[model samples]
Target: MLKIFQDLRELPKEEQKRSNIRNIIAGFILIITLLIIMGFTTLGGVNTFFETLRHYSETGELLISLDRARLYEQTFEKENSLNSADKAQQSIDQSIKLANTWNTNKNPP
Candidate 1:
């Protein structure tokens, strides 16, 4: 590298200017390449984070629905009312819907 610079210093003024321009272009290319790689890596990490958050949210909602269904079932057992049975069925349906949504989101085509 030192020998290369020594030869460059010996070149004519116009040749030196061209060499400098080439060096600048090379530097810019290197910087741009690095930036693009970093940008993609950062974007991938962000996408993963959001997907995880969505999964957690769906899981939480599913759990809540299940809990509600359990409570309704217990109520129906105690009182033997048609209304409680219907509510439990509705909660089970909601839980099924959430699970489907979560599955679809987790495995997109």
Candidate 2:
């Protein structure tokens, strides 16, 4: 330990500074490389990550709600008939499935 301290003290101040800078740069490069590798290995998981963020954003939520409203509108727009009733039932089932997904996502195991 004493020899190590002596060697450290013998290192020039400028040399120590340069060494620290190199180490910092190396650490940053390592982090960036790992991130790139992870993104590539995950098959565009990074894109999905950003997309999820966008989907949760205010504008994205508004657009999604609008889409849901449009779906309901279409279901209601159909003429009253057995076929229309079947379509409405399908829509209801889909809505339930979506709701279940939401619940599961919010309360993950």
Candidate 3:
């Protein structure tokens, strides 16, 4: 590499200018290639992050549904109201639907 630089320094002005242009073009190509690779990597990371957020949101909804179902059940047990029983059943059905959705999203075919 040292000898190559020494030879470059001894070249004619016109040859030196051509060599410099070629080096600049090569450097630019390298930088563009790296940028393209990084762009793809960053895009994949962003997609994965959003997917994780969606999964967490679905899980939270499922948990909330289950908690509501439990509360409704306790209310029915205490008051023995048919309305409370119906609401509890609805909450349980919502929880099941949410759970199925979460499972499907987590394991896509």
**Candidate-wise lDDT, in order:** 0.92, 0.70, 0.94
Q: What is the TM-score of each candidate against the true structure?
A: 0.67, 0.37, 0.81
Off by over 4 Å in 2: 1-51, 54-78
lDDT score at residue 79, model 3, on the 0-100 scale: 99
Candidate 3, residues 11-68: lDDT per residue as tens digits?
7777879999999999999999999999999999999999889888898999999999
Q: In terms of lDDT, which candidate is stronger, 1 or 2?
A: 1
Off by over 4 Å in 1: 1-21, 100-109
Order the candidates by lDDT, highest first — what do you get?
3, 1, 2
Where is model 3 poorest over a 10-residue stretch in terms of lDDT? 7-16
TM-score, cand. 3 vs. native: 0.81
Clashing pairs for model 3 are none
Q: Write model 2 residue lDDT over 46-85, tens digit each, in one string.
A: 7888767854663444456556655665766765566666
- State how far residue 84 of model 2 sits from its true place (Å): 0.7
Q: After superposition, how far is residue 29 of candidate 2 from its true place, in Å?
A: 9.6
